[model samples]
Target: MRGDVMGCSSQSTITNFSPQIAEAYAILRGIRFAMDAGLLPAEVEPDAKTIVYLIIADAPPLAEVGIVISDIIHICKHYNIWVLFTPRCANMVAHNLAKVMPAEDLFYLEEYPPYVESFVLDDKAM
Candidate 1:
């Protein structure tokens, strides 16, 4: 979530990687986007627990994916950023957005999409 706001969402396509690697790549991309948008003190919630732990530990894993994780850690050092892990159920709005958005199409919205409004409200209430 971006501060106390919960409706914002962004998605991008990653090529030539496993699902786990792609997830890491997406988180990296999201962090970069937030930095570019001047969203300082950013808070990131990735559904992938392993990747979150890897980033938080600042310990690069073996292989090419470690390079991406290392870059994420490097960029995060410049800003006040916290990477946390949230269960998929708690990230339904984003899950839904990813499903509906076409592959290779990067979708971003400041407010919750109409289709996911209920989920957003439900999350807020909880």
Candidate 2:
């Protein structure tokens, strides 16, 4: 559901969107790219399901997220992955961490701040 996504160019890659939207787009794109590149096993293809739940602290311009979501859904349908949206509360620790932590720290759990445990557990639960 929630993830610390990094290394995405919001300006160019995610059109007319906020940084958070771009970040979400990057994860979906990354998944598709990984599958196409043989990084994800072929066994996880059509009929293999993955539940994708993305968490956001603030509501985005739904129109933009919709467009990307549609595309993501199409690809996911091909791979049998279900995509879901969830609202995240402001008190979520990952939100605070993203505002202050370095990119590398956000990527790996061992490197993240201790408070991120809640976020990680919620992500895994999804």
Per-candidate TM-score against the hidden true structure? 0.82, 0.37
For model 1 the TM-score comes to 0.82
Clashing pairs in 1: none
Q: For residues 18-40, what per-residue lDDT tens digits would candidate 2 score against the true structure? A: 75556556546545644644443
Report, for every candidate in turn, its global Cα lDDT versus the true structure: 0.74, 0.42
Model 1 segments more than 4 A misplaced:
1-9, 12-14, 103-109
Q: How would you encode candidate 1's per-residue C-alpha lDDT over 8-86 as one tens digit per residue? A: 5556454678877787888887787777766777888878888889998989888787988998898888788888998
Candidate 2, position 101, lDDT: 32
For the record, the alpha-carbon RMSD of candidate 2 to the native fold, in angstroms, is: 9.5
Which one is best on lDDT? 1
RMSD of each: 2.6, 9.5
